[model samples]
Target: MHHADLFGPVDAGLPEGLVYRPDFVTAAEEAALIDHVAALPFAPFQFHGFEGNRRTVSFGMEYKFDGSGLKQAEPFPGWLLPVRDHAAALAELKPEDFVHALIIEYAPGAGIGWHRDRPVFGDVVGVSLGAEAPLRFRLKEGSKWRRFTLPAEPRSAYLLRGPARTEWEHSLAPVSALRYSITLRTLRAA
Candidate 1:
């Protein structure tokens, strides 16, 4: 059987509830955020018995993948209030609605695997900084899969909500250079 090349890369359209915006932050603002990130302490990301290559720090609420569950970290810092507000606006949510924040540092060649955000989280808003990486998405439909690659450019932001947030799984490709990202998540009400 011969496979059609057209079946591989789906350049047709993006998924629903997915919004991508380039140049979400100014150059000066990105630089300042990077400087602040550089000053903060970061710990190795821990998964279910594995240490991830990336370093991360969580604010508001930290979710433990070790089956331990969610725990509170520090409140959102004063410096991040404006950023949170902007991301919230893009996601059509209030800043207070985004109760969990994460700052991650990706070393060269470090990347995350395919996985969706936990069910406890409602929506995801992310800001990419310092460098660019491809954020890939996948959805399995029976025996077939649909995939899309999103370029997470520096100083850019994206919002994932509704079906995109629930039905699709997203991951990042390893970076060729050091990179930083900010993830703001809203919690689902019990």
Candidate 2:
């Protein structure tokens, strides 16, 4: 199928401001990116109160959530400029807008818990490689909950902005196989 057929308005009655584009990267690009990530030094993700099941290497401005808030780390590496530029173009965001990235590796059975990106960040964009996984979303409504799932296929990219960034929490279930993702974010204006 044509790549365009894979994209549409958010389904299942979810809020607006989400963009999912399949085949955002060609197969060749995917292979190169995977190889690049494989050569990087990956560290297990750890935070104040939680630890991630996946391994990650951050570039640009690394950010850590200190239980109550976000903390800044070293600047993103110069080597990441090319990938950042590509991701910004795919997400239709200006290059200057994306100031940070996290390259995460999900081994089989690795998955992230549900949570919102910190307020310090804006406009989350992610590129998926290696395998497909369901990106789940949930929002609390009084005593009930509303949920939705988006399949993130390899070579695809997704953008989360507006309501999709602020009003919902997102997560991935245990991955069935190896997968990698590059998540880019911009800092919110002071």
Candidate 3:
């Protein structure tokens, strides 16, 4: 694919600045991921606070993990070696165990509030699948917002690291259909 077609047009950066990768994941891979998750039982989204509180709300199903988090529901035997291991990437920078949160919603008009990943993690990774949704990122405490209108194509991934992870905030707009994201993060050492 041509460089321009792959990334499309370049857009202004967010307040903290951000990097954009249009084809983070291929369409075929995206479909497989969506199908896999769709087969799983839909449960209430779970939440874990920085203070060590764990809770589940009926409105959504969110999973929060610390250190020992795996990308999939069932662990793959030889799962995620250094080649694609996010934790390995983070280990280069900090010593804390990594944490992550994932939420899957099937119905339309469901959305998450505008918020930044807490300072607990050094960086954050967000992957979108099932249907296209518009993602907006704004500078923390700033009124201006930069939006990335991503197509709902399957297997799409976005990595927000460096200053973007540390200084900016992001959120998704309300939409119907199956939408889910796998988030990867690294916590600060105790």
Per lDDT, the best of the predicted structures is 1
Q: What is the TM-score of each candidate against the true structure?
A: 0.94, 0.85, 0.59
**Candidate 1 Cα errors over 4 Å, as ranges:** 1-7
Each candidate's number of clashing pairs is 0, 3, 11
Q: Give one digit per residue, the lDDT tens place, for model 3 in 1-190.
A: 6543553443454434354445555677566655654655555544443421111211111234454433334332122222125433433433123334443553567666677766555555555666667676655234543344434334555656776666666667776665666555554456
Q: Which candidate model has the greater lDDT, 1 or 3?
A: 1
Give the best candidate by TM-score. 1
Displacement of the residue 24 alpha carbon in candidate 2, Å: 0.8
Candidates in descending TM-score order: 1, 2, 3
How do the residues 1-190 of candidate 1 rate in per-residue lDDT, one tens digit apiece? 3242544645446788899989999999999999988888899999998899999999999999989899999988888888999998898888899999999999999999999899999989999999899998888877877878898999999999887899989999999999999999999778
In model 1, the clashing pairs are none
Per-candidate Cα lDDT values, in order, are: 0.90, 0.83, 0.49
lDDT of 1 at 102: 94
Residue 64, candidate 2: C-alpha displacement in angstroms: 2.4
Q: Give one digit per residue, the lDDT tens place, for model 2 in 152-189.
A: 99999888988889998899988999999999998877
* Model 2 stretches with alpha carbons more than 4 Å out: 1-11, 66-79
